[model samples]
Target: MMAGSGRDESGAGGVDDAVRELLLLMPRMVGRVKRIPVPEALQSQSLAPRHLSLLSCLLFDGPMSVNELAARLEVAPTTVSLMVADLSAKGILDRRADPADRRRRIVAIVPERHDAIAAWLAPGAAAWRRVLTPLAPAQRRLFVDTLRAYEAAVAEERREE
Candidate 1:
């Protein structure tokens, strides 16, 4: 289902054409946007989006064992272990033996870098704020929900590939 105007037959065709245009332009637009400077603090950190995603997940959800993080990320436990170890070496994350289970390792962000990461993210955050500010509350909710749908669709496509 398309957002904005795909709810009824009268608007379905128009929304379809608009969606086609959007899909055609998105990759080109993203290619340019990807060049935006990483926040200076993150400039040399070499953190990919997925890496930061792991950090964000840890930060927001609190420390978790590697297998749990892998499940949350829909990736292999070994992949999570490697990524966590790398981040730990970089001093941006820490991994400790889970107190309740000696065999489990809990991973968490370093705490100090959260602010720095937020600073680096401010530009994109501000841009999103500016774009959403003019929308009505319900419209903003719809936009967010639609964007999540798109994100899921892209993730599913990647998984298939």
Candidate 2:
């Protein structure tokens, strides 16, 4: 049956059409994002894709403690600590004792590395901003929720396999 013809034995083609389009579009989108080159300054950092989320959280929200970051990133505190330690060792991040809470350390991108990290991350952020700009608050929320659901569904499927 034609996917987008809006008619089929299933009563409607909308869902199937959307799925077909996304299945085709996702790989192309991933490939293009992958092609975005790592900036020269960060080339030797050996950063992984997971590092992007950590960096984005810091860049947008300012310095935060490992527990705060772990909460935001939905990862274990130990996981965030390990990443922070690795980045700190690479000179990409700095950790300082919080004045209000000396026992807690705040993690931030090194001042010298901020521009490079921003430059590397700017394109993706800008693209998302542009895409989401026209969406109403509800629509944007729905879009984000949909992506989260898809992620959970994929993880569940993978676990079952």
lDDT (0 to 1) per candidate? 0.80, 0.93
Task: After the best TM-score superposition of candidate 2, give how far the Cα of residue 110 lies from its true spot, in angstroms.
Answer: 0.4
Query: What TM-score does each of the candidates earn?
Result: 0.64, 0.92
* Alpha carbon deviation, residue 48, candidate 2 (Å): 0.5
- Model 1 lDDT at residue 74: 78
Tens-digit lDDT string for candidate 2 (23-133): 999999999888889999999999999999999999999999999999999999999999999999999999999999899899999999999999999999999999999
lDDT of 1 by residue, 1-161 (tens): 54655374335466676778789998987775577667777677788877866876776688898888999887899999899888888888888888998887788877788777666556666788899999999999999799889989888989998
Error of 1 at 54 (Å): 0.9
Off by over 4 Å in 1: 1-15, 28-36, 122-161
Worst 10 residues of 1 by lDDT: 1-10
The alpha-carbon root-mean-square deviation between model 2 and the true structure, to one decimal in Å, is 3.3
